[model samples]
Target: MTLFELTNSLKRTITESSYGQSEKHKLLQSEYVSHRELVQFYQACNPTPTLLSLIRQTKLHLPKYKTYKQTKTKEFLKMMEKLRLEAQEAEYRKLINPDPEHTTLYDTSNQEYVSPVQAHKELKNQLTTIVNVFISVGSVSYAVWYWTASSWGLRDSYRVLLTVFFGLLVLVAEVVVYMGYLNKIEEARAKESKKKEVKKVIKTYDLTLDNLTAEKL
Candidate 1:
């Protein structure tokens, strides 16, 4: 059979078989059967068989299968144990502090958790730095322009008066733009906070150690 036909036939057989109900079978169907390497291996078979029969027949011939089974079994056990411990700790925390107030916020953009105080301090420092840079650059540029204009026959007094007016205009414009930027930041933060709140509803799963032997296949 062609590779496409063979793949479809194998998938159909797997779905109908009693083994299809197994987690191992599910993993195989999802991650392994369609893989190029496995497909190539299947193609090489003189008369291709179902994956289960192929594995059962070739288990002794492929030493890597035994090694893979052992490694995956250990890894699976470790992961399950870690999950169990985390679940237990969560349960204990819930019992100890039934209605714990969450002051910490998750910054989804940065993918970090921070307390309100820390977040405020960070934002304040960032804004201060930005304002300082803008003021320094504006002051230097205005000084250069004033000096150049004065050299080109503009009166010093007139330049000084113009500087005051220009500075005020720039300041007002900056304030308007900065306020709009702050509003946008606030809106984005509110949306992210809502997303984080929704995500806080954790979904618990019933995890079990499925047979790792099929994984080796």
Candidate 2:
């Protein structure tokens, strides 16, 4: 065939096919991108108009088309909630009977980097506990001194009993304060442990969103 005839035939074939018309609708009705993938897709896909058009004809509506939200039917919502509950129950089971051989998908920060401030904080907590113990002992000694040296024999039976009770009250107050300090220390330790156990999951950052934005020109 002649070169001119061949070129015309190719054009006709493409025109007859669904090549020019979009395969996808104006609103992306087929697939969904994960929240984790949004930043990657936004940066990479915004530059290539042909690729964006092929994927969906709604590239213009990207930044405003509710990129982060998902609206579902009642049935889907119920199913998702049920599945979430089942997954939570499975996690509880795994915690109760953790298999040593099985590898877990989640990981903790196995880093050995130590901060000086944190070390100092831990030392301070230990020193505080020691000080609290000594303070409690001193309080008990003072209570005993008040009961014995503050006229135990001279006072009536009722008066002596009342003085002994007041001394005991001082000891109890110190004990209660020490117990409260211990509880607070435990809570802080638990919080720090929890933070260390959970690894920080990250997503793509520093996206060129200006390219996706509508231009006046």
C-alpha lDDT of all candidate models, in order: 0.57, 0.52
Candidate 1 displacement at residue 53 in angstroms: 99
- The sequence of per-residue lDDT tens digits that candidate 1 reaches over residues 80-196 is 999999999977865764433443464233344567998999899778967875795589559856675967667777776667766667777767777788799889987875663
Clashes, model 1? 0
Candidate that scores best on lDDT: 1
Runs off by more than 4 Å, candidate 1: 1-117, 120-141, 148-151, 196-217
- Candidate 2 deviant stretches above 4 angstroms: 1-153, 196-217
**Using Cα atoms with residue i matched to residue i, what is each candidate's TM-score against the true structure?**
0.33, 0.26
After the best TM-score superposition of candidate 1, give how far the Cα of residue 49 lies from its true spot, in angstroms.
99
Q: Write model 2 residue lDDT over 1-217, tens digit each, in one string.
A: 1111113332333235343244213112233433333334334434334434323422222333656777799999999999999999978966864554444475423332347898898799878876776666566655655656565644455555655566567667767877898799878866775662444658765456674463423
Clashing pairs in 1: none
lDDT of 2: 0.52
